[model samples]
Target: MIESCSGIYRIKNLSDNKFYIGSAKNLKLRWFDHRKLLRKNAHFNFHLQRAWNLHGESSFEFECIEFCEFEKLIEREQNYLDKYYHLNVLYNLNPTACSQAGMLHNQDTKLKISTALKGRVVTDEHRLALSISWHKSDKCKKQNEEARKKASLSKLGKKESIETRVKKSIAHTGKKQKPHTEETKRKISETKRNKKNVNLIKGDIYAEPS
Candidate 1:
């Protein structure tokens, strides 16, 4: 039932009887998330979205196959996928029967994703929201030295596009910046000396030169 929902859920297409299985920490929240996406015709899974648009929301059903603790959710979900694994015409878009928790995509998978996402357009409003959320996110607010180092390394050798630069400049047009204190400047200088891969632009004290 909805009151005590958790663990695995199945979204069944009543029209064809095909379905997809998934796990969540809170079943109620996950159901609403899927419903919102399907209603907006913006689900990440093209197969499911196409079905929803064709059959409409009334032709679908949300069923809780079972409930389990949060930690057991992935294992249980994997079991479900194995039970319903198909060779062809499967409803699931996920390539694996395993959970995605703490998973780092392999280079091949990353390249495939990058290729698949080529020419995808993000709306300006969505881009602005993402920038604001990333800056204000508490998840990275207390990053330790290791986390900070890893973050910096991941962004190494990346270059911003001219359009991105223009957008950033326009966004910062009226913003006032405070000068770095002497101690901050020393740390900056020390970091520059320690890292040979960094590029520094002439006038910018924050980022390396372009």
Candidate 2:
């Protein structure tokens, strides 16, 4: 016997000839939530919910309890729906959105993984090659070291948060920010570029001496 909360449910809306696939850690609660949404007529608020309510007929049917990890279960359910029912052809990102993430480290994690592996999987030969390559390549070694340092620092100190950064960026541009000017660009470029060299260069570098 399988518990309702431990697996996925595939629901069919008979009136519209469309299907909905989803996995819930607590399947009973999820279904109950859906029923509540329908009862309250909150359908038009979201895409799938809207479809399920407006086009759906009375007496929906569901198949219960396929066992797999949450991500794999959602994927399997979606595959079944797509192959047989052919409902959600566009923007079906249910499984993709289920991935675990440390928001602060998501980009860094992806970059580190891609930079380190570049589509190569680990095998005995690959491991040996990697051992050899790690010693041979300064760039790889540096990247590995930097990644490790960043990870360690993240553990030790309070990392700058993605949410905070987004809020700060929005605040900086709030309703009345001025556009960039040529003088502003020149000042910025001068500040970032070689100040000593620019100061030491011949008189009035911006002008061509006649």
- Compared with the true structure, all predictions reach lDDT values of 0.73, 0.56
TM-score top scorer: 1
Which lDDT tens digits does candidate 2 get at residues 1-210? 225554666555666545556666666766765665555444322445555556653646555647666546545554554565434532232322232222233565456545645654455543553455445456778998999999898879576699989998988884876788999989988886777666667457666868
Candidate 1 wrong stretches, greater than 4 Å: 87-89, 95-210
Local accuracy of candidate 1 as per-residue lDDT tens digits, 1-210: 563455888899999988878887778888887887668655656677778889989999998988898777766886777677664445775534444456465676566557756787766644554554444445557555568899899989999899999999999999999999999999999988866444543335576657
Query: Lowest lDDT 10-mer window, candidate 1?
Result: 196-205
Model 2 ranges with Cα > 4 A deviation: 1-3, 43-45, 55-59, 69-210
Report backbone clashes per prediction.
6, 0
lDDT of 2: 0.56
